[model samples]
Target: MPPYVPRPIVVDYEEACRIRDLSPKASATLSRRCLQGMIRDFHGVREGTLAKEIEKIKDKIDPVTWDSIEAVRKIGNIGAHMEKDINVIVDVEPEEAGLLIGLIESLIEDWYIARQQRAERHAAIQALAAQKEAARKAGPTQGAGAAQPNP
Candidate 1:
């Protein structure tokens, strides 16, 4: 089955990867946007900047995952807000930009796709159990001499 990435998130991530080699800066910017959107959509965090939102949910996610998220935020910020006067031109290498895209893909799979698959499995199990139960209930009455034979 296809992965469960949201349409908007998919669009950004795809665009980011598409231009990763030619335009690392733009890729990083899109990656940052994708990360922000994922946090909002998956974790239901809708406040402050990406960094602040991540900080709010630091305890909810694994420490390693949290750190990765912060890294992307910092790098993306540099790419997004280049300042000429400050002379802050952070270079986003193609490999680094690829990592950002990778992180987004992982988040989509881990958070959205896995949850959805689990829910579907749970529902299927429940349905099968219900069917078996109904069949068991009917079996006792329909067999042998439990009821009068039809003429």
Candidate 2:
């Protein structure tokens, strides 16, 4: 997890990792919650349901990424919501859970890490521009070997 990521999201992601093999369902649930928190914090889209919130960002994000988010939501749904028949037990494979975790990791990189890097780059450019402007305003300086004007 990136150091810039919020503690809540990191906690959920870590918990998901801790139990991914032991309980894929629980892990998926945690991943789902983590995704929701990210959407809320990063995108500022807090709808009634995760699905609705995701829909709001469909045009904002790339199609492939949107599809991945939908996939996570659907797969996580299995663990989050109960089926009509209480007796039935639908299992989520460990591989599927791992996929969810991988998606979360990718999102953290794509969203938070990428944004921070971009901001830093922009700031650096601004600082460089400021330095150049200052130097330009100060005018050219004469070299030590250059002839000095007669007093």
Candidate 3:
């Protein structure tokens, strides 16, 4: 629903700054403190829902995708609690955050893609099932056991 986890990085960044002895510098595109606030809500990710739904359609997806989503979810937690150098909590240089950003992005992408594919597969299953039922009822029209050529 939201992003991944509900908390934003900005809040933690600010807390980090307080713990560390650094002030927001001029060149940093995002000070962890303020940047976290900008992150979208990520708490509503329904792991239970996803897990249950995925179980029904796992065969239609790339396993790697599922793994990526899981990794992103775990990393999100780590990033939330990440410590910067000097406890700023540690420095998350732009380049470093960039890598993490990539992971997060990939994770989100995989999650959505998997979900869509799963939905499609589910619909297909229902359609096939319905067709089979219809066929079953229309059977034996001209089989060997049919009425004796209507005499």
Candidate 4:
């Protein structure tokens, strides 16, 4: 995970990874919570359930990415919410949990890391533009061997 990610999100994601093999359900739940935190923190969509929050950002993201986010939400939902019949146990396979974790990794890269990179690039462009503008304002310099104009 990138160092810029918030500590709480990193903690949840790390915990999810730690238990993915031993307890897929717990891992999925943690991943789901981590996803929700990302949505709320990054996208500024904090008004409703994870599903609704995802819906709010549907247009903001590409269809494929939106679908992937929805998939994570559904799989994580299995661990988060109980079935109507309490006797039934719907298990999330280790592989599925791993996929959720992978999606989170992608999102962190797509959203946070990409945003930081974009900011840096923009700042660089702005700095160069300022340098050019300052140079233009300073007027053209005379060659060292050029003759001087009389006052």
Candidate 5:
């Protein structure tokens, strides 16, 4: 939301959007929910230190995904508390609100897709490594060992 002028450096992306009547869309909501779902699926953060937990495993996430997720999170905070404009919240515009929603949706989608791709890659690597380890352990088979299959 851009129409509402901010108080100095203070920023409230959510509230700004609301004041300007640019509330988030259903797709944005769905995307945000999906991202939340991932958080839930990975770690049942039912209570404290959710950010720390996510940070602890941050390296496991793709950098782009992580960035997008963080951006959406920041914007979400602004949107959710935009109306709470006090010493705590910031102001925004309807246009800014729409942008935030779009950004949120895109980021969430990227996080989901990137995470899946990475998981698959990791699984494949593990499988290949396991196969190699097994082959090494098996060595040359019995008489085949005596024959010296390779120089």
Candidate 6:
């Protein structure tokens, strides 16, 4: 499949990917921030540290997804803390950072885009069903004139 594009926070995710090669730490930081934002925006997880917020939303998501999110959280924790002290060093390979970026993209799609698409599809199906029900009640439009011949 093509690259995953999250409808929300697309720029932040994209920027994280863009900076992956140059600075894995920065990329991971961005990915972590994106996850925090997603939890707050989508799940209404507004309180506590990111780890705690994840706990609040964890049960709602599947085990596998939650695991992946936690992995990103771990990487992000290291990246975020390194900024506080010069002696605190966390090593994250480029590929590891990329994985976090990938996770963020998937979360965006799974959490936001897919839900939106499902809602739209449900609305369309309901409309069609309503139309069909109306047609059935109308009883084939009696006396609307005979079938027209093709010219």
Query: Candidate 1: where are CA atoms >4 Å away?
Result: 1-4, 141-151
Question: Candidate 5 residues 63-136, lDDT tens each?
Answer: 87677666545555554434553666455444555665555445434544555777789999999999989988
Residue lDDT tens for model 3, 104-131: 4443355544556777899999999999
Model 1 Cα shift for residue 101 (angstroms): 0.7
- Looking at model 1, report the run of 10 residues with the lowest lDDT sum: 140-149
Which lDDT tens digits does candidate 2 get at residues 1-151? 6688999999999999999999999999999999999999999998989999999999999999999999999889999999899998889988989999999999999999999999999999999999989977987667775457779
Error of 3 at 111 (Å): 2.6
Overlapping backbone residue pairs in candidate 6 total 0
Record all residue pairs in model 4 with backbone atoms less than 3 Å apart, i.e. clashing.
none
Candidate 6 ranges with C-alpha deviation above 4 Å: 1-8, 83-88, 142-151
Selected candidate, larger lDDT, 3 vs 4: 4
Off by over 4 Å in 2: 142-151
lDDT for each residue of candidate 6 in 1-151, tens digit (9 for 90 to 100): 2234434467778888999999998899889989988888888888779989988987899999999888888888787875576876778889989899889878777877788888889999999999989987876453566355568
Instruction: Indicate the worst ten consecutive residues by lDDT in candidate 5.
Output: 1-10
lDDT-superior candidate, 2 or 6:
2
Number of the predicted model whose TM-score against the real structure is largest? 2
TM value for model 5: 0.39
Report the lDDT of model 6 for residue 63.
95
RMSD of 6: 4.8
- TM match of model 3 to true structure: 0.37
List, residue by residue over 35-101, the lDDT tens digit for candidate 1.
9998898889988788789998899999999999999998898778857678656688999999998
Question: What ordering of candidates by lDDT runs from best to worst?
Answer: 2, 4, 1, 6, 5, 3
User: Each prediction's Cα lDDT score?
Assistant: 0.87, 0.94, 0.43, 0.93, 0.50, 0.82
4 against 5, candidate with superior lDDT: 4
For model 6, the run of ten residues with the poorest summed lDDT: 1-10
